[model samples]
Target: MYQYDAIDHQLVAERVAQFRDQTERFLNKELSEQEFLPLRLQNGLYVQRYAPMLRVAIPYGMLSSNQLRTLADISRRYDRGYGHFSTRQNLQFNWPKLEDVPDILAELAEVEMHAIQTSGNCIRNTTTDQYSGVIADEIVDPRPYCELIRQWSTFHPEYAFLPRKFKIAVNANENADRAATQVHDIGLHIKKNAAGEIGFKVIVGGGLGRTPMVGVTISDFIPRADLLTYLEAIVRVYNQHGRRDNKYKARIKILVKALGIDEFRLRVEEEWKHIKNNESTVPAAEFDRLQSFFTEPEYQTLTDNPSNLTEKLADSTGFSRWFERNTFPHKKAGYRIVTLTLKKAGQAPGDATAEQMEKAADLADKYSFNELRVSHEQNLVLADVQQDQLVDLWNDCKEAGFATPTLGLLTDMICCPGGDFCALANAKSIPIAEQIQAEFDNLDYLYDIGELDLNISGCMNACGHHHVGNIGILGVDKKGEEFYQVSIGGASGHDASIGKILGPSFAQEEISRVIRKLVDVYVSQRTAEEHFIDTYRRIGITQFKEAVYAKAN
Candidate 1:
């Protein structure tokens, strides 16, 4: 993790002080709630259903042990002894008092973290592969580039007040764990050309809302040095033309739709003429400075040791199951990447208790370097765990409620804290997720149907990324009655596409059955080795739709 220098420290401290004053003014009745809306939102404070929720940004999902400890402390002191980890890899406290937020920001500043840019119509948190630096297939570490963007976008004078919120993602691997280069406002995929020049494949105009659109490629190759400049061009174009009349119609996707992708590309190209290589252009020295922050840790050189772990797995079925599902190949010779699952059966999808947070921090220090990563899937990552220690780590995690090994499976769902916490939600999402998990408790069945994304949102805001899930369940209100709308075949990776809705909504009681029927259809129709997505694409949603709804009719 990058240590904050004096300037970095001071910047956060100043922002905290400013927000403190603003919050005090609002509480004192010097400013109206309407007047304080943007300011509070910019600081990541939201007025939710029960109380104000304060979201704290964890840049690129990277964290130090100290930072994790800070989060644990914040949860213990300011919240209800827990914090909700969001799909964007941020943390939200659902019950923080409005007056306590500035104090929270000040505490976060001490650990080189903040809540700035976690919300409001500005460049939000930049997410990359949780395994970016440690993954074997990565082209290069994506965090340096993410850090560069973080610097360029933080309180950027021109982009501070955009027409709507904008999001960007960076992906360096073909695996797409970051879901980078997806349907973001701007997506960048890092690659090295045949000539050995590093550049990005730029995609623009992708988003998920009432209308979902996959981002279309706008530039084939944007050189590494000009990344910031190119990004500025994209945001500038959106800022200039994105609608302002209606908040719902102000996102870049609407602009992208109105202009057509070809024209949008041309317009961005025209705008790039003036800013392609200007002061905002990332200098080689600056890149070097940022890269220094993300240099690989001193890793021990060890011979391949797959024997003991293989033998252990062959003996203990429980260990074998966990090892197969929770581990990924690490870049180092004898290391592995491990995900600490927070989605145990019946737990809220991303809520980590203070004890769990502390335990995670302690384990990160013991098993890996004192470095940890919060994944966009709302889980924690131990990026450099040794292969030999996998069982030991798993045991510890199991004891601490961190070892479920259900990554990318049916139970590893992405769900928003809907009606219970969010003021905008029309229905409850956490219970739906819980019901689905209970219905699909068979681990072997889940592993058989691999790599399926299940996302749920209480409303059309798509916070759960329902539009991009292989199975998207959206909550809707029909005359004050809670109903769930199901969608199928959505993807958020390289070939990002939004799911199509299946007929009418179902009553809350029917949601789990509908999901079961949809899964059953996929299971019955899939060819050999076909995943849920592969089967869905081949058979389309019609068969699954009929299977789920026909019985009800």
Candidate 2:
């Protein structure tokens, strides 16, 4: 985790003070609702269905125990006793009093966290693989570059307010697209060329909303030093030409689509000519400066697989299942990346209570060198847990309701708080997530079904990332009633693809049955080695579609 330097502290403190004055003026009637709209949005405040929602940035999803505790404290003191973690690796406080926001901002400042650039037509959080440096066989650790992007994008005068909000994600892993780089305004696939020098394969115009499109690759490689200036060119083009007339069509993805990839590339390249190789180009000293902050945590010398680990697996099936689902490979021989999935039996997919957050902090301090990472999938990560203590950690996680053994499984779905919270949502997503979780509570059944991504979105904004889920459930409004639409064969990762909708939308109550029918079809027809997604891709949507819409004989 990157600790804030003096300059970082000064910049954030100044922003907080500025926002405090702005908030006070708005409350004093000097700033009307319309006047305060962009002002508050710049600070990550949103007027939700019932109340205001404040989004706090977790830059590149990295956190320290102290930061997590501060967040838990903020959640408890300022709003309700819980916070909703969004798919973008940010936290949302749904019930914060508008007056208390400045105070919340001050508190967050103390922990080196803030809500800046989290909302409103500006460069938002720059996210990356949650398992950044921890992954085994990694190509490169992306945290430094992500931090570089953070510095380059935050309150950038040139891109302070674009035609629409923008997002950037970085992924160094070749095997998975955990960062969903293909669906970001700009996706950086960090890799080394034949000479083993680092660079980025830049993908632009990838996004989902009213219009969904996978971003097109703009450059085969942007040299490591040229990333920043090249990025400037990309955003500069979008800012100058992207749709400003309609918010719905303002994202860079739409701009890329309208201009076509070829012309978009040409535009970016033409713009890059003047900007590239300028002062903005990252220098060797700058890389060294940022990389110093992400030094390796002190790790113990131990076997990759301990005898106790094997014994514990044999002793308890529950622990074994959790270990299989929640733990990921680590670069360290003795360490593992353990995720505390928030998808318990009844809770919303990513909702973490204050107590849960505090306990997670405690666990992080105890086992993970006091460090944590928030996954894009809306779960918490103890990225350096030792293999020897796997059973003890599992027990602690089970007690804390984090060991649901559903990571990358059917119930481990990515979901957004829909009509229940967001004013923009067409229907409630939390209840739909609840329905599916309840339907697949059986551990044997869930594990047997194999890995599946079941994502739910309240609307087309795709905050839940429904377009990439194996079974994407989208909430729709038909006539006067709330209906749900189902899409199949969607996937996220190296092989990213959008899902295809089956047919007419169904009533809310029928969603669980529809999901069940889809699952049944997959289970019946899938080969022993095939996962739900692989089956869907192989057998196609016809079988699942028939089962979902099949009439009873």
Candidate 3:
């Protein structure tokens, strides 16, 4: 995690003071709601269906134990006793009182946190691979570059109000893209040239929400020095040429679709000539300074699978299952990346209670070098844990209800708050997610299903990233009734592709049955050890579609 310097601290504190005044003036009736609309949004305040919701930015999803404790305290005091971790890797408090939001902001500022630019039509949080530096195959640490983008884009006057909200994500790993870069407005895939110089393969005009698109590569590789200038050129072209009359078609993706990537690239290249080698170019010293913050944590020199690890795995099936499902190989020896699943029975997906947060913070302090990462999949990551402590950590997590051993399984679905909290949702998402989770509760069944990404969005907004799920479920409002539209064969990684819709929508009640049918189609036909996505691709959508609709009929 990047420690907040004096500048960072001052900036957040000042923003909090500014928003406090704005919020107070609005409440006094001196400022109208229309007048305060953008102001509030810029501070990450949203008037949800039921109550005000506040999104606090966790830049690149990095959080310290102290910060986590603060968030837990805030959840307990200002809002409900839990917070929803969104797909963007930010935490959302769904039930915060509008009047108390400024105080919330003030409290957050005390801990080097704020909600500035989390909302509004600016470049939102620049997300990246949750396992960036820790992942062995990653080309370089992307978090430093992510922080660079954060410093460059935050309160950028030029982009504060684009045609629509814009998002940028960077991925450093060449083997797999855990960051879902292909779906971002500007997806920066870091690569090295023949001479071993780091650069980016820039992908532009990709997003989900109404119009889902896979980003087209605009530049195969641009030097690291020109990153910000190139990024500015792209955003500048979008700001000037992007649609403003209709927000639905205002995204850069729509513009690129209209102009074609070729024409868009031509214009971006034309615009880049003037500002390409200006002050925006990253200074070597500055880059080094940012990189300095993300140095590897001190690790004890221990052997892999240290004392009792294999013995415990052999002894306890639960431990073995968790070891397989919840843990990942760390870049360092004797360390493992443990993901704590937030999806469990009877609770809404992506939500962590205040007590859970505090417990997680404590666990982070003990196990993960006082650092925790919030995954894009809405789970918590302890990036560095000694191999020997695996069982102890597993037991602690299991007691806390985050040890479901279903990281990439069907029950470990990514779901939005949907109609439960969000005003724009077409139908309820939590219930359906719960329903699917309950149906797939059996560990044996889940393990058999194998490596499925199930994502649910309450609407076309695609907050849950429904388009990229191996099995995607989207809520559609059909003549005032709630229904679900299912899709198959979508993925976010190397073979990034949007899911193809199955057939006509099904009622909420039939969702579990529908999912079961899809699962059956895969299970009955899959070759040995094939993942659900591979099976879907091998069999094609025809079989799954046939089975789902045939059973429905």
Candidate 4:
């Protein structure tokens, strides 16, 4: 993790003081609700259904042991004894008092963390692969670029208030895109040209909310040095021309759609010509300065498959299953990246209790080089766990209720805090997620079905990223009653696609059965070794829709 320098420290301290004053003014009636809206939002404070929700940024989803402990302490003292890890790789405290948020900010500042750029209509947190530097399949570490963007975009004077919130994702891995770059406002796919020079394959206009669109490749190749300048050009074009009349039509995706990719590319190119050679073009010194922070940790030299690990896997089926599902290949021979699932049965997805957070911090310190990562799927990662220590770590995780061994299964769902907490939501999402999890509790059945991404959103805001799920579920309200809408064939990766709706919505109670029918259809239609999404794409959603509705009819 990058430790804050003196400038970083001072900047965050000043911002905290400023927000404290702003909050005090609002509470004292010196500032009205409308007047304080932007101020509070800029500080990552949202007025939810019942109370204020404070979103704290985990830059590129990286965290240190100290930072994790600080978050756990914040959860224990300020809000309810838990915090929700969001789909954007941020953490949200759902019940923080409005007056207490400044103090919370101050606490976060002590640990080199903040809420800045986590909310409001500005450049949000820049996320990347959770296994950025450690994964074997990466082309280059994306964290330095993500960090550069974070620093560049933070309180940027020109882009403080864009037409709408903008998101950016960077992917260095050629095989998989865990960051789901294709669905972000700006997706940077790091690649090497024919001459072997590094550059980005820039994709623009992708988003998920009301109007879902996969990004179009605006530039086939932009040199690494020109990344920031090119990005500035794109945002400047959007800021100058994007719609301000309607909130729904303000996102960069809408502007890209209206202008067409060709015209949009032309405008950006024109803007880039003015600044491409300027300070915005990252200098070699700056690249070295940022890259120095993300250099590989000191790792011990050991074999890829240690005798102890092999023996343990051979002896215990439980250990083998957990290893197969929860762990990922690492670049280092002796190490593995482990995902500690937050999706326990009966618990809301991504909601980690204070105790669990503290436990995770301890575990990270003890076994994983004192570091952790927040995955886009709303799970935590120990990116440098030793292969030989897997059993002990698994035992500790099992004790803490995180050893689910259902990483890509149906039970490991991505969900949002819907109507229960969010004012924007039309229907409750947690109860629905819980019901589905309960219905799919059988591990044997889930394993037989293979990998499935089931995402649920409260409404069309797509906070759960329901648009990209293999089996997407959206909660809808029908005459004050909550109904669930189902979609199929959506995916998020190198080949991302928005899910297609499968006819009418179902009642909350009927949703699990609907999902079961959809799964049954997949099981019956799928060829050997085919995943749910593959089968859905192969056979199409028509049969699944028919099966689901036939039961209802």
Candidate 5:
């Protein structure tokens, strides 16, 4: 984790003070609701259905155990004792009082955290692979670059008020893209060319909202040294030309769609030529400085396949199932990356109680070098857990309700806090998610289905990233009645694709049954050893649609 210097501390403290004043003015009636809207939004405060929601940034989803403890403390003291980990990898406190937000920001500042850029139409959090430094297939650790972008975009005067929110994701692994880079406003695929020079394959215009788009490749490669300048050019072009007349049409994706990829690329290239060698061009020394913060953690050398681990797996079916679903191979032989699932039956996806947060912090401190990561999939990662301590960790996780063996399964959904919390939501998402979880509660059945992603969003804002789920559920309001729309074949990663709508929307009660029928179709049609997505692509959406709708009819 990058430690904040005096300057960083001062910046956050000063911002906190400013927001405190702004919040006081609003409460005192010196500022009206409309007047305070942007001010509060800039500080990541949203006036939701029942109370204010405060979104605290967990930059690139990295957190020290100490920081995690602070977050837990804040959640307990200020809000309702739980926080929702969002798809952006930020934490949202749904019940925070408007007056208490400044105090919350001040507390966050002490831990080198803040609510800045978590919301509003500015450049939001820059996310990357959750398994960044620890993954074996990675060509480079993308965190340093993510940090570089974080620093560059933080209150950048040029991009502070874009037409709409901007997101950027970086993926360095050739084999897997846990970061979902293709669905970001700016996606960077890091690679080394045949000449062994590092750079990025840049993609632009991708986003999932009212209009879903997979980013188009603007540049096959941009030298690593010139990354910042190149990014600046892209944002600059969008900031200048992106529509402002209609809020619905203001995003960079809309601009890209209108101008076309070639024209967009030409504009960015022309702008880049002027700024290519400017101060924004990151020097080798700067890269080295950032890289130092994310160097490999200390680990004892051990065999890749530990004998005890194999023995334990063979001994306990419970342990074996959890291990298979929750753990991933680390770059280091002795260490494993463990995902702590926040999705449990009957609970909202990604809602971690204050106690659960504290426990996770304690576990991270005890076993994983006191570091943790938040995944875009709404899970937590202990990225450096030793294989030798797997049993103890699993037991601890099970006690804390974080050891769900449903990663990539139907029940482990990515869901937004829909009509329950978000005023923009047309319908409730948590209920639908819970219903689906109940419908597919059997572990054996889920494992048989294999690697299914079900995502739900209350509206077209797509906060749940429903557009990229294997089964995407979007809440729709038709003639004042809530309905759920289903889509299939969506996927995120190296081969990203937006799902196609199955047919007409279904009533809330019909959603779970529709999902069950979709699963039944997959199970019936799939070939041997095929994943849900692979089978869906092979058979197309027609059969699944027919199965779901025909049953309803």
Candidate 6:
């Protein structure tokens, strides 16, 4: 929501122009594929299995209705008539031509958006709770600080080329919508201490791959003002000492593991002594300037429950079903947080059509305050919708193919666009997701399963955050055959932890049955009030593995 200032605008324009020239040179043969790799990556371009792919940044997953409309336009005009929203809350175009990238970026700049840092070994997009300002439980809105990191990390000269890609997340809410701050390269949970001073409880080096590890807490409290300074120290230490010889071993998680958390903390503290409150730390004036961008939208006064809509829903079970599942609490009275369900049973998860996109934009304009957000779970949010208009909104959404009542259910899956699109993927993920959805078509069963985040990725890049789902599935290719791997005990929000691998990979045909077994294990092990994640953590993955893997073997 931060509007670009003159300097911000100019900087982006210049970057666009620079990328345009770089793209032109690459297309003209002035730059080879190898030569253009890093340049294009810094601009969020990737040469995928088919054509080139471009990822556009939706910083912290917040977008205005104008931005959404712009995205729809870009998808229509630039590539195919659609774009893939990625797990990191960014958008990806699978068929972008190298020659057209510059123009694409120029268009994005006009909307105060860019592709910078969406990829590459440099600091990638700084993510935060999508419901930051609107969520009732938040101690403080984390976007201002996120924007501060955006400024400090953007094209930072010294840290521009790190050994591996880095990710950072900020979660201010106790519920941990941003995940438990667990598998990110760095996670920041913004909180106020007993003294009522704001600071971050920093987690470092948790990631998933061939070697997966939970991030260790490095600092109990990093004073709010010195957040950037402390972050710089962490990255600098990683940049200087993280394994550079082997690309596979280059993430901060590896460095933290090798040095051990105690020594890593000590080293970071020593480094922080010099940089703790340097120029990079966000000053008070800039913080206020950024905060102004997220001012609350105007709303009309109304009752908590509207009689008319309640009466209508009272008659129709269908309408009530959707209202119950898709709606969440909003900070404002008479306003509710509406999640537009992207999961239609048997459909590829999180795939929205162009018409669906437009309908969302229109709804954002008509009912919400011309603002929309994309959740990490790959769903869209109309953060503030009036209670009176809920039924009408649901009807319109239903007509537009946007009304599905599967929020936080098994159907509401987090998935990466796997082998169908991403070259890095080892197997196709969408079809597997469809198969699982088909197997568990009973809504009551899924709802009874209760708030399970089932995530899948084609490979270990963990794009779907397969590492943190209640049921995490990773697709692996064994020899010439495609196989799916299972992990359990993963979670993203409030109590984030990377899932443990269940055992060996399964043939693609066995995936659905494996999932069924995992679910049955949960049903048997869980108590009255425990969610899937709570049950998984309480009992551990051993029993689940015994149920699913032991039989398969």
Predictions: Cα RMSD each? 1.3, 1.0, 1.0, 0.9, 1.1, 1.8
Top of the candidates by lDDT: 4
Taken over the whole model, the C-alpha lDDT of each candidate is 0.88, 0.91, 0.92, 0.93, 0.92, 0.85
lDDT over C-alpha atoms for residue 439 of model 5 = 85
Model 1 / residue 384 / CA error / Å: 0.2
Residue-level lDDT tens digits of model 2 in 349-369: 899999999999999999999
Comparing 4 with 5 on lDDT, the higher-scoring candidate is 4
TM-score against native, each model: 0.98, 0.99, 0.99, 0.99, 0.99, 0.96
Clashes of each: 0, 1, 0, 0, 0, 7
Q: Model 1 — TM-score against the truth?
A: 0.98
* lDDT (Cα, 0-100) at 481 in candidate 4: 88
lDDT, candidate 1, 1-553, per-residue tens: 6678888888899999999999999999999989999999899988899999998999989988878888999999988999999988899999988888888898889889999989898899998888888887889998999998998899898878899899999999876646545778888999888899889999888888877888888888999998888888888889999999999999898898899989998888899999887898777898889899988888888765668787888899888878878888887888999999999997899889999999999998999899998887889999998888887898899999888978878889999999988999999999999899988898888887777889999999989999989999999999998888999988887767789989899888888898888888988898998889999888787888778768543
Q: How many backbone clashes does candidate 5 have?
A: 0
Q: Find the 10 residues in a row with the least total lDDT in model 1.
A: 174-183
Question: Candidate 4, residues 1-553: lDDT per residue as tens digits?
Answer: 7879999999999999999999999999999999999999999999999999999999999999899999999999999999999988999999999999999999999999999978899999999999999987888899999999999999898888899999999999899999999999999999999999889999999999899899999998999999999999999999999999999999999999999999999999999999989988898799889999998888999788889899999999889989999999998998999999999998899999999999999999999889999999999999999999998999999999889999989989999999999999989999998899889888889999999999999999999999999999998889998998889989999989999999989898998998999999999998999999999888887898889878433
Global lDDT of model 1 = 0.88
Clashes of 1: 0
Q: Residue 71 lDDT in model 1?
A: 92
Candidate 3 segments whose C-alpha is farther than 4 A from its true place = 551-553
| Model 3, global lDDT | 0.92
* Candidate 6 Cα deviation (angstroms), residue 308: 1.9
lDDT minimum window of 10 residues, candidate 2 = 488-497
Q: Which scores better on lDDT, 2 or 3?
A: 3
